[model samples]
Target: MKRTFHHSLPAFITIIFALCAVILAGNAISLYNNLLSLRNTNSWIEHSWDVKDRLKNVNVLIMDAESSLRGYYLSGNKTYLGPWLTAQKKIEPEFKAMAELLKDNPVQSKNLVELKALFDKKIQLMKEGLAAFNDGGLEQIVMLAKTGEGRSTMDEIRLQVVVMESEENALLAARSGRFYQRYQIAVAVGMAINIMALLVLVLFYQLIARSFFKRLAAEGELKASNEHLEARVLARTEQLSILSRHLINVSEQEKAKLARELHDELGSNLTVLAMDISMVTEKLRPTEPELAERLQRASATIKTTIGLKRRIIENLRPSVLDTMGLAASLMEQASEFEKISSLQVNTDISDEFDKIDPSSAIALFRVAQEALTNIAKYAQATQVWISLRAADQGLRLLIADDGIGITAEALKKSKSHGVIGMRERMLLLGGNLTVTAAANGRGTVIDAYLPFNPAAQADASVAG
Candidate 1:
């Protein structure tokens, strides 16, 4: 099955969130490592500068020691030897510290060893010059100075210190360059990650916007389709209502016409036949006794046929509904139904129905008649209650029977034309009918509500 946005949206969002989280976590870890790398590189640069400074300090101390020794040899001043001794005391420790600082670098450590050897040689030469000055006085010292051997050794010492200082400077420059490169790389990586995250966010936003608009458009189309369907349904319902009303009116008119024809035409013809039979019976009674008996029997049969015709006409449209009003008619029907169905029929019909419209009166009477018929056929009970009263600016008729109740399937079935006819009659009069299990839970109740407005009487008259 194809999935809708609603179905897939959560998974899509979850995947996006997970991706973003992973990317952010990776960036966080990368940035932390980069920060550590930058700090280490910076430390290396600082250490290289410190080593270079230390090497320069060692050279300055050696020069001071040489100057002090030369001064002592030339003037034989013990005060000059004091500086020389102090220099000798400080230089070894300084040289050792420089070596310790460079211990991590094998190349620098080797260079430091060479530099220390030169330092020792330079110091030994200074000591020998001092000893010669002490033993042979100023003359030996002058010869020593003149020979240029100590000067040459000092030049080599200076050259060695210069070489060491140059190496430290080179190391410092390399370390500085490395630190800068690491800083640049960290910045570049951070910027790239940020840009990618921003692009992802923008894409997510666009996707959300597109999804929202698509859903909105779909909803709009659905709403329009629903509205069109509702309009069509309403139109069909109205048309059916009108057609049903017209059919009902035509059927009632036809029944009235047929009842009038039977009562007027057939009834007159039967009356004349009865009078002729009575005249013939009088004529025959004086002559043939058997013929007179046959004529009397024939008259009785004609009378019975007239009675049956009257009943059929009454059933078609009761004249009592017009002459005696709704309440009296309902009471009469209740009595008739009680006699026919052998059920106890109780009635409470208010006189307010006397003012009810003629059309509404007919509909209510028919509904009651149908209810009684249904009860006679279906209700296996001994009691029935029929009531008609004024309620809610109209009339309510309730017919209840203590019998087996109507089932939902039976009530809803289309084959129950009698019930459908009752409902249609009530609907035509702007009323409603409901059949339900009695509130007492014993049987069924048929409740009919027909609204009556005195003002609408004029409209009913016009329509009639």
Candidate 2:
């Protein structure tokens, strides 16, 4: 429990710290957005005021143009025209600046357009009157002054300026409200973040203590669960062992039964065929040498077929293992294996193995069989050594080769059916099997040991 607590404490604290950081980071982003909104709102509010100032400047320029023209006309002085010319130069530039600023606002842009037209009309009226007075058409000037067209145009220009100024004032008011709203949100978020950080710092230790207890409980539950699982696993393994042992016995019995059927059925037929061929060869005419040779060849082929059938039956169950016992069977097996695989097999088998249990005898023979088969297929060896020795209460069989050695990975491979079978058979007999590299890692070696108890065997036989 203490070990688990030590292991989990650091991890738990790290998780808590990460969670706190995420919360803080998310709130910090919110606060930053609030401040950003405030900044944008203040910027637009200042822009609206600047736009209002431009509008006022434009209106003053228009008024200056009207007043300067009249002053020049009435007083007959060129100095008054200077102010009008300066106003004219500056007015169009102001209108272009305001247009650029209010382009994004549909209402304001429309107002600016209308206001520029009014100012243009007012300037045109003033210019005509001045022109008429300068041309010595005093009557034209007087008539224009009487008609009040200049007065009405100036009035319209004034009204248009007011309209533009009103729009900017309304935008300024709205931006001001927005700026204050964003300021309030930023303040609230900052306060909330501070409170959350303080609470996290205060409760961190208490959370660690609670997490330790919960972790301890989980560990205890896992321990008990592991124990129960182990018991169940052991029970299941025993059942599988029983099933595997039963399967091996059934397979052996089936092989023996098949061998018997082949011997009784095909063996008799082949033997009769050989006898009939011999009889036919003796009765053939003296001049018919070809027919006689054919009869002799048929007889010889029948004899070879019988031998082949016997060899196959022996391979299936090995009657020699049961009849002459494991020692003689191993010798016969080695001799045949030499002829087929072209590898020399040296044996040091104990004669006493023949007196042992039949099951142990067959198991040992099968171990040798499987080992030799593997050596032939994969070992690439020129020589093999087979040894059987009495050790303690069991007999140990070792089959080693002088070929390319086995790999540790191949020995441990789960899908190696031959290796698995030999191991399981030894395990069924309360023994074990091992495969390894030979001396100097030159080739592969298989070691199989089976515990023997004569009394137990007798008792088992009686029980059976």
Can you give the lDDT of residue 125 in candidate 2? 82
Tens digits of per-residue lDDT, candidate 2, 349-449, equal 88775767777878888999998999999889999999998887889999999999878887778879899889888989888999987768698889999
TM-score of 2: 0.50
Residue 182 in candidate 1, Cα distance off native in Å: 74
How many steric overlaps are in each model, in order? 0, 0
lDDT, candidates in the order shown: 0.84, 0.84
